[model samples]
Target: MKNFLLLIVLSLYLHSSFAQNLLQPELEAFYNPALRPFYFGVASGDPQPHSVVIWTKIVPENLGLQQIHWEVATDTLLQNVVQSGTGEADSSSAFTLKLVVENLEAGTHYFYRFQHEGRYSPIGRTKTAPEGEVPLLRFAVVSCANFPSGYFNAFGDLARRNDIDAVLHLGDYIYEYGSGGPRKKKKNFSRPHIPNHEILTLQDYRTRYGQYRLDPQLMEAHRLLPFIVIWDDHELANNSNVSGAQNHDPNSEGSWEQRKAIARQVYFEWLPVHDNPQRSIIRSFRYGGLAELWMLDGRLEGRSPQAKGTGDPALPSASRHMLGEKQTEWLLDGMKNSTARWKIMGNQVIFSPLNDSKVFSRDPSIRMDRWDGYPAERSEIFDFFYKNNLRNIIVVTGDVHTSWAFELTGDPLNPSKYNRKTGMGVTGAEFVTPSVSSFNFDEVVPKFVTWEAKRRFCKKKNNPHLRFLDLNHHGYMTLTLTPERAQADWFFVKTLYEVDYRFKQKGGRYIEYDGNQVKKNKKR
Candidate 1:
């Protein structure tokens, strides 16, 4: 009898070990293993008073069917479970899981985990928004995470810091170009993307998302915090426009709508987001009594693309809209009605004044893809902010691949605005976070510091309320806010090609037009 019992016990133990080993494969692969119990990590988004969208992906045998189980707990160790449920992983969605967990305890941190097969995933964490008026809010505003150029030291660094309320990811979460996008070392840098070709089909899109999720640093970051994401052109094609894009070939690629849908599906499958396409990403979330975060969708409902030439003749009459009039109206309304101590817009592109003349002769191509290319619209947005008493408003942007702190003036269009000599302010503040592994300005600019100096001079000279511009370095920015002032710190990552997680030491860098300023919580 004893011998028989021991044999049964040994069999059970073996089965358990086999199940545990399943996690290792998901954790290691370049492609997403949906069965891995979130071995890639987990995240939550669109937080409300008592609920948020919980997201995790499950890999199956042949991108077929998958069963995903999720659980939420009140304690970090997941000791006392509060909520639990199961969902079928849609293969069409690349076996992604999105669980909308409601009725969570307000303003509290909760630990979560997903289970499939016999293996349990690593402990995942999330939080619910505060119920009523609360004074302080802390958010980590970040953007531009690319894969090839360097290490995600910034994300790894932020994971260790515990003071942030939520992570605001602006855009450029993934690069879509062939391995030639941007690299730290031109010769020995990137590997051919799994698709090995520009993405245009659903399969290609799914594969790209899978590759990015494999980044350990990204996984760690997702595991640690709730991410709020917005997409820029790279998610579809480079310099993407409403009708078409700079990267898509009319003859080679298929229909634009087909490509766009695939891109959106993959994005929804991979990330933790609220699944409402009709309701624009131009949504707002209030953090207790502290602030209201407005995330914008700058790509979809916009007008025509930027004018082509030095003065892309298109700029003059092309009805090309960046954040269509409706979304822009929504933003203005959010700013006007927001009563939180600080009002923040999770912007995608640069919103400050910029001039091509300030750029050096030997620098990378001056991108007309930013706000600099849309003067009329930019002016209208600024005018709205100025007209309203939107005092502590701050705009955090990504797409530019540089760190910039600008002193936004009331009138953004008035030429010869700033003195180009002093760092001052007018309306609110705008913090432009740098890229993840994108090239730093110094590496590409002819006389790096001189070019930056020219930018500073021209911005200040042409616009008075503008303050800072780095236009170099590849990393993320942390925004901390308080009842007194809102502060943002630019954090630079050491490298990106490898999955190493060491970031350079950082300091408290505040936005110039500061009130209710909050400093970076190094450990948070």
Candidate 2:
């Protein structure tokens, strides 16, 4: 009996050692064999006043159906369990579990966890949206975290903070690139894509996502805060549209339809978002009477193929759309009817016009992929705002990998329509958050060139309504909204080369309630 017990102990030790060795060298520190089958950790998202979605993944050693148990409680120890249930995972969903815990209290915090056999996954904390007279709300706005480009220091910094209620991820969560690409190095660290190839199939996308979730910072952030996420072009392919992506090759790789479908399937399976019946990602969250957030789907919905140049004949077509007709109507109508004091549009690209002639030599149509590409539709949205006399509208955008604050107006150049200095006639305000770790102007261009570009872009004579621009930085923004004003504070991480999490407040901008123009925040 003594010999048998010793042998059992030795076998268990070897099993743990082999499992640890299976992880990538860079991600080894984050991998915990004790969590076992539940390696991806836990995440919660799409929080409602009365419900929230909790997610997890189980990679069983054997290829078979796995019984997973989940629990939600009011205490971290999970002794005061509020909701409990069981779920089955198999190859069908890649063993990912996204379970909605319903009948939760409004404005309340909850602790949740998932279990397989006897092992328990990480405990995640999430909160439900507040209802009825919310005095304040804060969100960390972030985007563009390319895995191969750098480390997720920004996310690490965010995870250390406790002030933020939730994280608003405005897409480009992961890049579909190979290992040896141009953006494969960051300082001394060699961040490589897992598959070491351009991901194009179902398994490829899944593998990439698995690699990203293994990051300690991202996993910790998700474990602490609920995330409201939306995808941009990079999630599927570079500059993807309804039909095809610029990076996709139908002849060589596969059909665009098949690739897109697979990407969507994997996205829903992995993330904690609620998969509606129609699979339409356009959804709204009501924060009591204070604010209402509308997360838009700009990439896969109804966008026209990007124009080749300003001379492209399609640029002038009134039919060309960015948000498409149905989504436009839904958004405009929702804004018109919303009773919330603040209407926040969670956008994936720059909405205001940006004249890039002064900064770059690219054609005017080079920015056609953004709202500038679909001018007619953008104008229509502006027209609706003016016609309805909409007030307190805020557009939070990502994807540019830079920070910019714009005073939304009929036209920034037309003095008669918009007074840049006095800020007489403005439709709304837009705050563009910097990328989390993607390449900024400084990375792609020489330091001196980027300095010159920044100087030209921020010149008062050009783009007068442009209040602020930061062409060089890798960080996130904190958007704090109250009954009287909304403010965005930019925070920059010290470095992405290694595991440093120190950050500093770069700058900030704010707009008072009913004040359409953005103003520089008073220095602290």
Candidate 3:
């Protein structure tokens, strides 16, 4: 009887041993450190209350499928591992790997990293959104990072900031153009593009992204914070719409459809963003009851061809649209149904109309690339907000390489129509972030005596709705949201030409919304 009991115990032990040995071969083979796979470092994005996507690119010495292992921990030391998984890095995705780690605590900061063979990647820090009630939310807003223009000092500054919750990149993640065009005279400009010409092919676009990702400052920024990004014109071409672009000549640069597909494909592959099945990057993120951010795709989703300057009388026609019918309806519905205190729109182009005719002795010329071109659609959105009695709507915009703060009125053509006594005609507020390095109005305009004064005079007189405009600074904006007010603080780099430039607070603006009325506050 004792021997029979011993035999049963032996059988159970053997079964357990066999199960453990089954995984040993794969585990032992994965620890080879000879292959330095994590070359581009790590990044995280599209964070939710319970999950976040962690990303890494493996540059294998040879072209084949490589198995990569990833792990997420509650602490920076990675001793308390919460989740771990293994994924494949193949040539299909340019060796880029993205893993969505789930079932995490809300409003919690996590440290994650990747492993290829025995080499480990740089640890990336990410945080999940708050679940119930958030007292404050802060985001660093940036855009239009033209690599050849200058160094990414703005990105470095953002990487050093420990206060920001996330980085909101409002498109132009990478430019398709090569060096020596308009930015030829930029001092200390060194990095040239990979293709060294206008990028049109799939490989060309992918190579451009790779070059930009390798920027030390940019990589460091991604390593530190999760980025909520959207694409603008430069990702595909200059002034691009749904069908065609000004920089993309179908007669010379192959089919527009093919080029657009490849660009979008590579964009998803390189960035740590969740690809929408619809191929549009338009999505929304909610921060408890503090703010609900709706990121809109204003470039490629469903934009009509821009009118020629502002001379075309059809600029205000209902036919022209920036965020086509479906997207517009989606935005309106989301805003109406949202329970958050602030409705924030992560828009690409300028939402407020800026007419130069009021200052310059010229026709009321507007850049058709912006919302001014699609006046009817803009009005439709405004009408919905007015009808719903929605308050605390703030549009954060990029694309234009200048910082601006404006009170969005009901009518751009007749700003005086709004009720000045009660502040009733205001639909919302708009804050435009300056470029990371892209040239602004100061760079393009010719140098002369009183140039600064003349530029200021033109901007102030032309756009009455504009409370502040900085045409020379190259930096980003910090948006702080609370239950009472939404504040935007603009920080500019001392110089983009220097690698170790300091960031100085240029100015700040705040909008306090009370019921249907809005009050503005400015700090110089």
Candidate 4:
């Protein structure tokens, strides 16, 4: 440990990790180390296939200012030329250079590489979204990755898949808390974080992002494809809403606005995202005419204080809003107005009915903090889809740290007969992707959890409109969207504690309940 500290300090002394000099050899450690090592790492995000963002950072001996060259190839052999470019990184943005390459065949796999200080980064590969209404848009959905809970074996497998198009991370990208239980810091960081604990400042958030970005599997996944990202509570504080957070007490932690601003600053600085003035991440992206992805900012514009959410578990109110007025309106307007054949909402929370046990006599306010918490808001959204006949609508989500695929039901006027075989509201379909590696019910509520997956599955098949639900396992789900169908492949990882990150694959079905009225993944 002392040797590691010595190395870090020496690296800092020779070349600043936060490079103060602007004209020196750019890819320096102090400016955010993108230095090469025995281990090869490369990354690309914010992808449009032909034009993608490639980034790399290194720690150098002198850490002088340097210019790096980037090349994008038509073939892995690099013999066939398509597009190539050059970019220089200095202390300004922390030694990371994002090269935007252009003009390639639609829906193609292009190899990219970076050249700096005579060292080459690992060959990074990225793909473009299919142009026309092709058969699939297979990619993973994940969130809330706490490094100590486990490894990102799931990310490793997803990165190896040459078939996937992208990754949709529905927030909790990295937790804002200190090491808990098994998840420990790789080393004692130089500067102590805010509150001597939780992240409440720019430096805190930046440190967390840096640690997460250092994960080889995570970086590999990002290098291989475009990532559609959104943040949930933990990015700032657990169970946070517009007003405050579950992890913060204004009396103890300072003003909520100040903490929020710091969180947002680090997130925007690290991630490639557009600023939403509405204070929500309710934005839309398209894949020609096949499908349109509407990512939500469920945390920022939501109603309710931080503690009253899942942490409170009993405050289900018709008036407790999640997507606040404006953002909810934005989501509705987008859903109602989109031209794509399939409408996929990247919701951070589960959007379907989630009940505990088989008890049908319990009150509706049983499950709080999720869509179950905001009954009225969920109703309005459900009614929009049902009334307008929004076909092939699927909500992909994360944050529960457990996997669930549900046949979305409708408003049960009295909230009774919810678990009954009949007399229930069933609207669309929602798939909840588990966390990359957060503790599930098995670990926390072990005795109560079961392996049958029946009662849970009943939540899907019982209500005429509900479809599927898997409450265990931590992995990502891939969706293949077509004009006539949209299929989801729920891939699982074998283990998260192991260091090598070996993963196993699980088979998941795709739904085609629109034109053909089938509910299976008929593979290409």
Ordering by TM-score: 2, 3, 1, 4
lDDT tens string, model 3, 1-524?
99999987887686445423221222223322432566567899988899888899876644557899999999999999999989997767778898788999999999999988778998899988887888899999999998877889999998888888889999999998876246436655576666688988766787778777778799889998999889999999999999899899998888999999988888898888886666678989989988899999998878999987666888879988999999999999999999998999999998876675534335444367888788899888887877898878899999988888877676644646554345557766788899999887667665552365346544534555666677777899999988888888899888777697577886577777553333445443
* RMSD for each of the candidates: 6.8, 4.3, 10.1, 6.6
* lDDT by candidate, in order shown: 0.69, 0.86, 0.80, 0.65
Best by lDDT: 2
* lDDT over C-alpha atoms for residue 516 of model 1: 26
lDDT of 2 by residue, 1-524 (tens): 99999988887786555434333334445557877877788999999999999999987765567899999999989999999999988777878888889999999999999988888998989999999999999999999998877789999888888888889999988888876334434546787787788988776788788889988889899999999999998889989999898889889988998888878887898788997765667899999999999999998999888877777888868898888999999999999999998999999999998777887566575587889888899999998998899988889999999998888876787778788877767866899999988888888778898899988888777788888888888899989999999998899888878888788886688889988679888885
- Model 3: runs farther than 4 Å from truth? 1-35, 358-366, 412-416, 419-422, 447-461, 515-524
Q: Scored by Cα lDDT, where does model 2 land?
A: 0.86
lDDT of 4 at 220: 74
Candidate 3, residue 135: the lDDT equals: 86
Q: What is the TM-score of each candidate against the true structure?
A: 0.85, 0.93, 0.89, 0.79
TM-score-best of 1 and 2: 2
Clashes of each: 42, 0, 0, 33
Write candidate 4's Cα lDDT for 225-318 as tens digits. Answer: 6777888888888878888766888998899999998787667656645434443456667776777788888788666652233435534455
- List ranges where model 4 is wrong by over 4 Å: 1-40, 58-66, 77-81, 88-92, 99-104, 181-196, 272-281, 302-320, 357-366, 412-427, 451-466, 500-509, 515-524
Q: Which residue pairs clash in candidate 3?
A: none
